[model samples]
Target: MNPIRDIVILCNNRMAFPAIQTLHSLGRLHTIGLPAENEDVKAFCSVFAAKAGVNLIVMEKLKLNIHLQEIVRINTLKCVFTMTFPWKIPEEIIEKNPNVFYNFHYGLLPEMRGADPVFESIRKQKHESGISVHAIEKEIDKGKIILKKTLPLRTDFTHGMLCTHLSYLASYILPELFTLLHLNDKGVQQDETLAQYYKKPTITDVSIKWEHQNSKSIQALVNACNPWNKGAYTQWNGINIRVLEVSQIQTATEQAKTPGTVLEINENNGLIIQCYDNTLLRINTVYTDEGFMSGHKLLAFGLKNGEQFASI
Candidate 1:
């Protein structure tokens, strides 16, 4: 049986706890990260450290070099297995020492290969998505697949839930992946040409565009933004309503109402709005900073039928 020795973890806090627990179960020793000056990075490290316990070491980008020197100065082993440490670690430490470094990404390579895979997946309405463990390079998320697993894109999913599910899948695959690594089986190369890339979504991207948007597309937008940032929105009688829920409305009206026009406000049903291609969007709920209220209340605000929501 191959014995596991030293392993380093580098990933977002969402995946950290599971990574630590899974690696420990496989008999590999690991350390958690520390807070850095970058607020997002610092918060991620802090939460991860709190969950991972005292072994956590907080280091700035500069301190990482010093820490690595000490690790090399004191330790005999030349190689280390890392998850998502931010520094550009030296190749000498990896190539010469035979250190194995692996990282996990939320999307399948040659497909949704970028920062916000779940949001992109929902936008595209892909039936399936994936979780991948791969060797990290200087470039982000491009590497040979150490392990991969397909997961369904459930309609009810939010970004947080999708991330959590992917983390779990990655955790389950880690033990097997390590076994493969210990057996001297490095993963194969990925086809660079087939890789797809996506940039992080901005506030403008999150705003709901009622124009040219169909019922299905609006539903995707709603699902993509939910339980996080309520995406792409417009004013309904000056009330800043965050669209939290939507669905396709079956109606007999063939008349082309203007896009974003409120067609009907049924207290028992929901607010039906005109969309592109004469399709209708039924808004189930709207959220304010205060809280979400019924779609009926939106109708009571004098946004009567035939009122348009075209962007100003």
Candidate 2:
């Protein structure tokens, strides 16, 4: 068997680009999947398309069943790899190479552990989000820190933008981290007290919570649900419309209208609707099953005043 030298990468294409580039720079590379693996193989007939490099092995699908054995074999040598959200890396792997394995996570570890981490961060409207490289342990995201970089959370940042920024950070940090690991440097331990846990989101979790939610809460909810999933929605005129953008009107002349009531519709001002706590939300965009439409045009299309939206 060939003695594996330097990194093996286990990540999707966009996120893996930096790792692949790093290997290319170091002249040692290996990968689990390639971009073309998803399509029908006959479509990629070119010689350039089908070739696999020594460092770039493309597996058709990732099977957890063989992962532990494969990782054990790889780690026995001096080889290192990059993994994000590993499905199955037995603790035996960690016990064998205690401080070698590392993965990048979007949120501060233990605080946001699970799928949809970017979404959870946006829901809380945190001022800062982080890209963390931690030692891979049996527990979820509860590993020792190798490197972590925090950045300001922009007001307009969606889940997509947040992921892009985090992935960029990972790409920048991983190679340097690998160099350190190669030198036998063990990273710092994480404070278990500071760690928190989050769960994978579900359809119910994405449903809009109309009652007991303020305008800011609603806005946070809207921002958190995009990229992979649509924003929390409600039925308007028997049609589902995902709330895309909303702005609170704090200087309204009076609070005479009930929450969810139509306050006004202007040719330029868009649709103004009452929020739960007497606040006004100027809805700018919404996604209907038929496609997206403006709240202003939705009302202009004859959706009546005082018509209720069904949101649990």
Candidate 3:
């Protein structure tokens, strides 16, 4: 009557590391399935499996389900876990018995239900952020929810910080989830009306659209892309630079200048630029050809005061 029998963990990132530990501690872990293509994750999983005395299988991207079939052959009883696993599960794997397959999703399901939820949540300046444990269905993030835990999204939180926070949160919630599974509790269905699948962010999504976005929105994008894309991008002197960080120092009563125009390059206040709503955003850190440097350094790099940023 044990629901955790014959468990297999399919993981591709460090986010799953804590969950793997929890599963093993519960004496429920069986096999760990890793993506062969990701050398970093594979290396971690290999060492983990050896140290923990567990079965490890490295499956190729296209042959993922085939590897799952192999695991299934060994034992028909099914239970599985997915954490930040990149590839989508084929229908065949779930068609047999879907309830036992649970995915640890980093984002709030049915709402922020797509790729890079970490970035999307921060960039949108979402008031709350959380983790969702759901039964994996054929569709992504549409699975019934087993448990959800949320926390206030901090103003200074970056993509990496939020991700690390949720990983620990996932570990904290897994025991409760296993209890529900033990009772044969099928999770509640998500509301279709509230669901929206966000696509993976593109260059355009990360780029700082100075002409359209306000100071707050632009800063949000900068935070969202930090420790990843470096920052929202723009051009100065026809060379690309990433705005890694920014701040709103003041506001203008009028447009004064075009959005993206450098209003002033101050020694103490740094590189202040105008935004769409006439708000003046002070650039604190940026990435240039010279590597990471202060926004004030843009002037030394030959960008003059009152000059407009080249539109991307």
Best by TM-score: 3
lDDT (CA) for every model shown? 0.68, 0.64, 0.84
Model 3: which residue pairs collide? none
Is 1 or 3 the stronger prediction by TM-score? 3
Best by lDDT: 3
Candidate 1 local lDDT, residue 143: 64
How would you encode candidate 1's per-residue C-alpha lDDT over 126-200 as one tens digit per residue?
887777777766566776777778999887666667777777887787668767786777687888878889888
**How high a TM-score does candidate 1 get?**
0.82
- For 210-298, candidate 2 gives per-residue lDDT tens digits of 66566777777777776556667766666777887777778653644655666677668888777777666777777776677677778
43-107 in candidate 3: lDDT tens per residue? 98899899988899998987877887787776644578888888888777788766767888888
The C-alpha stretches of model 3 lying farther than 4 A from their native spots are 1-6, 74-78, 250-255
Off by over 4 Å in 2: 1-5, 26-28, 33-62, 65-68, 71-86
Better of 2 and 3 by TM-score: 3
lDDT of residue 198 for candidate 1? 86
The alpha-carbon RMSD values of the candidates against the true structure, listed in the order shown, are 3.7, 4.3, 2.4
